[model samples]
Target: MMRPVQEICFFVSCGVFLLHGCGRHPLEVDISDIEETVHVERFDRELFEMKMDTADHAIGYFYERYGDFFDIFNTHIIHIGPGSGKRYPSFLSMFINDPANREVYEYTGRVFSDMEEINRCLTNGFRHYLYHYPDSTLPRVVGYVSRFNQGLFTVGHFIGVGLDQYLGSDCHYYDLMGIPRYLSKNKIPEKIPVDVLYAWATQIYPYNDSVDNLLTRIIHQGMLHHFVDAMFPQLEDSLKMGFTGEQLTWCRKNEAQMWTHLVEKKLLFSTDPLVIRKLLEDAPYTYYFTGESPGRAAVWLGRQIVREFVRRNPDLPLGVLMSRRDYQEILRESRYDP
Candidate 1:
């Protein structure tokens, strides 16, 4: 947390503006050296399939390879089943050794056989992070097939990637698994870098304040999204916002209307948790708005407020903004009208 605030502020002021190259900040860290420093472990291919012919040998290999994480691995992957603990041995055994699951493994194999491009994206993303925060802690990236349990998560210093979650949107496995179409749409390779970076960002700068109001929750998520956006400048706003291109367009077109609706309803400063969830949480769509309205409208609005706040204070560094605890102060300073 300290590193994110200190180093990011330092980097912002030093004049290194990537993309447009307009900032006065100079990059302090060498991008080339980051590859050697941060490592991404391919546990999916290397461990899961390494000795699949024999579970005993596979178990032994895992125990030796990840002695430090054997307990967590056992709890999350082996002992507990996807999304929960295994209740039936037959079900668990099928998930591990069934011919169909093996087919699923082979399916993932084709998609992830060449992780060169993904590795490069992840490396670049981490490099950008290190560039801003030189002393930032690095996580040991572990790629595993979670049977579509969790998408990606960080356990201690290890970032666990569930490879099965990215088997393309149209992959038949998703249909067989009964995953909703909307949920599987983002399971493409390009989204992996964002997922990894966002997961790491949340670990480094988690929301510490209470979420008693709609505005508070939005600003909190807005801060995280802003950090990720700065790190991945090339990613589209829609992708970072977790919206479709059309949905983003709808938001922009109706930005004024959405703001006006919030104001007319006096919902921005309201401390109603239900109201907060309606606007901020993920749903099929925001029910208050038209069906065409994108889900998570509050997050989008919060992002706008944050953008305006930064725009109004060009001299302010991102780290300083993140470090500030006064959400109300930020909103007031932003003078966010729309």
Candidate 2:
């Protein structure tokens, strides 16, 4: 949807932060701590390499092979530039640099791993739908990985949720779905038309049971869902309009039904930088700030939090509000410092 002018201002501030070297730091954990040996047979490696050579060919190959089982969103792909490889490392370093994030990341990783295992079991029993119908037009899996990396930056820098902290709220889902919805509603199409792009990002295949189910699963597995729900009362009124609880529930349930197939195939799990490009390109919402970076979202959210805090506690000084440690403790305690 149309972003408020304040949001634009917030975006500008985030740009300044980045320029000032205030970007999220990387985690201090050694690569060996989280790295897994990715095994691909010689034939698999050859095929994967061939697919990577041409983006169009890779998209087409995936769609031809698995289009039937999944609904491919027509999201734009971000082309990875030469220096972009450092982005993830940079993001991780932020976690390592911040004591709060380090604590949160440890907990979050364990929770995510647990959820992944459960999802693996569910997929094994039901079969992944994305594997059955891959779409050629769909963004590559690597693209998703990149988006996740950016997500880390936003969550860490703005929310200050430690790495181990489970979002434990519906906020994550609200963000995942809301950002795109806002982008689509605002008519800010990437290179592609907004409607076409929205259709792709929100498209559901036959495998997903319903949007409600999808929401339920996401909430059950991730902590962010709870956070979203907590802020819903405040944000919904401020935004002027948004989905009601019932509507969101219905949409999420239906979404789950539609995407079950894709989830089964593991198409949703990606780490490519191209995914971020596609998301921004296809976003329907515009920020007050101008830039191609995903940090804009974090800035917007940070501003919102600041505004809310000020409104609730008019007597509080701005200096205390900006204190990272104090603010983080408040967030961790689930209380507004104001």
Candidate 3:
């Protein structure tokens, strides 16, 4: 939450000056000495290996190993009801027996057979997290194949990453499942850590604003992306923002024009859910902009605003940057004026 406010405000200032973030940037520091690491549990492999013959033992084993997440996955994710309910075994069996689920799980093995690289990346990312917020509890990461039901999800201190969802954009399964090109193109291994940290950032510092407006929503989204930036400093903005290389280039070239459109059209403070969705949601492009622009283009501006805010306030710790909730005050402080 605090991190995102920093992200949101980073844009307010950056957006004003043709996305030039004159403010303090999130420092890229040496984290080689940080000992923190994250290891993802292979829950997907374990779940797929469950056999009815060993039902009693396996059931107990899952309960002991995964605890609340076991029940949550059963109820909230796969939607098979509570884990301990009488019909739970039958439902789980049905899921395991499903041909489609089996196909997806098997395919996941081919793509993620070795998770060492992923573990190393996450370790480095969390090292940054520890560097910034030493008091926070690092969430346990559990890797699972959800038959494309979830890309990433969080409850309490565990983060579930759906292996099936990140099986590369060109995976035939996506075409088979009718996944849109714009969406599926981002389903690559490189995006996993960024997506994971972003999800965790949202959970730790959720959108806590009292009023819902376009500016607030855009700033919140920008802050979330900034949190990801802090965690993974080297990640490309296009990947972090889920835009194509060309799309990102377009955003930079037209930053001022986009900001002007928002101002002249008087859309910044508007709270219409439709307007929010059109600007923030995934689509081929932002309907408000030329077809050459990418979806959620406004958010790109938000990121610039926050980047500037953080840049200008170099001395402010990340926690303080994110803790700032006054979106308007952030804007005023950012001095963002496209």
Candidate 4:
């Protein structure tokens, strides 16, 4: 966890503070004294509210608030040109004036009219993040309209969330866009914190190993999930794993069988990208497992191994666990018989 972007993990080893309560789990710590909170800026609203009469000042203020991210939003996110271009105002006007984008923006507004619940959720999770890394700053979260381009994106210290991508699984737009039901299952308000924390966790502990084998990647996935668990101790495993309750149950009931398959098939150490994708990508179900199993079911096993590793090694700090690179050694010591 001592990487460049993770330089903020100054006290990550000291195990500073966490959110503890009466009858709280041991994984949680006391964070009542931490006065920090997360404030999410609505970039979508500001973009839509930009009127022609006062477009110049509105653009100026938006630029001030978003700065470099403005260009990122336009070029990378919305597929528009750079925000600093001379024709940027016209580009923004075109986006605002487009009837289709307008519809999406209106729908997003109706769905996310009240962000209080989400703000509070982010604050609590980030508070735990801050508690562990006292020197880190809470990421500046901004909500935007990605027109179904992406669900979320992280750059530098800013996190962007697309309101349109999360307008309920049954939203007509998703149907119109031809999104699969299994993929759309995660398009809900509740997945925001989980998604955000996972994105941040990747940044905190990016996978840089040149050896991209199945075991290496699988354990990395486990480490990321473990980090998210530490940030939100009370969160349901289904939400964290992006699995339906039934899918999670299937994973639990067949954990041993799945482990046997991986080892018996000699697929645990395969470096084939296609094999890795089959095991890890989001789909109806993991190709290697039955249809009843969840996509990335192998990752669930990875998390279990990591959980066992941490459980067996009580004195190991979270930072150390995450910083670890010897995936095979970690798996061996995990003693994860199940």
Candidate 5:
């Protein structure tokens, strides 16, 4: 009887041990197993490389003449220095090296399908600048390749840094389109693939940190957009061309609503240098639709200033108009008053 009782106790203990596990803690399960994959396309590396090279050459030429401005820019605009060890490769190299980043580039290309046209406009504008403003300090050959390296690192960083995870898995197709009307019309999946490739294009490099900082600073300066716009009128046509007929129609139809949104969001002057720099630092998503911080700011600010100026001076010609030296001198004299 005693033996039987002892045997029963032993079996009970064995059963409990088997059910609970043999001195093992409960295993933790990862949530990733339940996560879904985001689907998106990649960018074309060769095309991107070509574009970057063009921009780089353009910027290099500018720097050679305006090295002083660059130095001042580094001091006043950019907070960081070359010693910070930031390393930015060419946009193409970054994209090819990181397979994960391709999606964003494809999305960017789709949204801005007329990028080549826009670039052409820039090239033409630069050439015009050289021809008309022969005495100006601006570069004569503002090639795409030259401009590519000027602030490429900073521009890339503003777009790419801290954005991989946000874009890689959370990006939606409609989000890629910069049009608010389109985004409102199409509802995308909650968790879409992030476009990392675009980030590669916008990646910030160590050597260009000063350039990035200075550009951001200059963008913040009041009236700078107006200066750029007065200098480059072809940009307006280029931007308009980026929109399709349907898109333009949609924009017109929703003009009131769009303006309302812009006013409410303080985006009407979103191109203001200060406003743009803030947006770049604070709202990366907004920057994407707007273009990189200073670039988008330049466009938006140019439009705003021209609209106001044209409204006041309706007699002004639609063609490229130059501000008289006296007017610039007066503005400079009164700069502190505003």
Candidate 6:
């Protein structure tokens, strides 16, 4: 979940918590305590409706309801125009008038109008976070339509989700926008909590150093995946890995060959950012080894290494595992020759 820029990140995990509630009316004995469920606060819906309706207090409403977040959107999401050397009206003006963006905003609302499922997933994942790190402060979750500019981002105590980005993969607009189908397919409501929670995880368990090599970069993702697993224990691995069923099966079948290729090519320890990007960054395809190979093969390897590390150190708690920053030591200890 670590942002590629400046932001605090953290993880969701399960450990070290207990709750009990009971009552008896004999001589009087009772105890009460309730764990709160985590959920997203829907400022996006209110903001979109206000813009659409041209409400009297639209500007004031945004300023008052979202406070500094308004400034953030202006700076990051909306101030710039679609092309270089061009300009657009302020975010508010643009949102109020753009026809296509308006449709996207409405579609986003229709798709996510009922966020009970999202709330439940986040609540459960957050409980796991609370279970492991009892003292951690939960971020204030909010929803917003970002015109597909930013999917999810966090700053200070706020975690903002760009609802438009997750419209079902089959939505025709994606094709119009030239988004390849493979990448678009994962843009579903089901993946929202994982993205948000994993982003939070990066805030907590940040990669302090720059990733200069394939091993570090992929291991960074692996750690995030591992943390998400602890947080959303019931979620499928494919969802966590952002892999299709066939992609996962391919990775599994070729795990050894993949590792062998990395070693044979001397890629693991090399500090080449370009090499790292080809293996770890999202793309239509990596196109390095085989055309059929999935992109981010390094991620699969990193997950395999972390799994091996955990297997070797079975007693290490999730908290401890994340706190350790020595990737080289983790790799060495993992004995991950594969």
User: TM per model?
Assistant: 0.79, 0.22, 0.91, 0.91, 0.28, 0.82
Sorted on lDDT, best first, the list reads 4, 3, 6, 1, 5, 2
Candidate 2, residue 204: Cα displacement in angstroms equals 12
Q: Of the pair 4 and 5, which is ahead by lDDT?
A: 4
lDDT of 3 at 221: 80
Residue lDDT tens for model 6, 1-338: 21122121112222112112354211111111327687888877676666434544565666576666666765687654322122433446567567766777777766776787678778878777777677778787888887788888777777888877877777666777899877898887677888988998887777765555777767877888888877766566677778887888888888888888888889888887788788887776664657777788678889889988987987777789888777878898999866
* 285 Cα displacement, candidate 5 (Å): 8.8
- CA lDDT for candidate 6: 0.72
Candidate 2's error at 167, in angstroms?
2.4
Cα lDDT of model 4 by residue, 44-141, tens digit:
98888878778788878877888766768888887778766789788788888888888788778877877777777788889888877888878898
Question: Candidate 3 vs candidate 5: which has greater TM-score?
Answer: 3
Off by over 4 Å in 2: 1-95, 116-118, 121-166, 170-245, 248-338
lDDT of 5 by residue, 34-128 (tens): 22221121212232444554645643543464444333323333322321124422432453344434444444334333334323333433343
Per-residue lDDT of 320 in model 6: 92
Cα displacement (angstroms), candidate 1, residue 263, comes to 2.5
Residues 253-292 of candidate 3 have per-residue lDDT tens digits of 9999999998889999988999989998999899899999
- Each model's RMSD to truth, in Å? 9.0, 22.7, 8.3, 8.5, 24.5, 9.6
lDDT of each: 0.68, 0.27, 0.81, 0.82, 0.30, 0.72
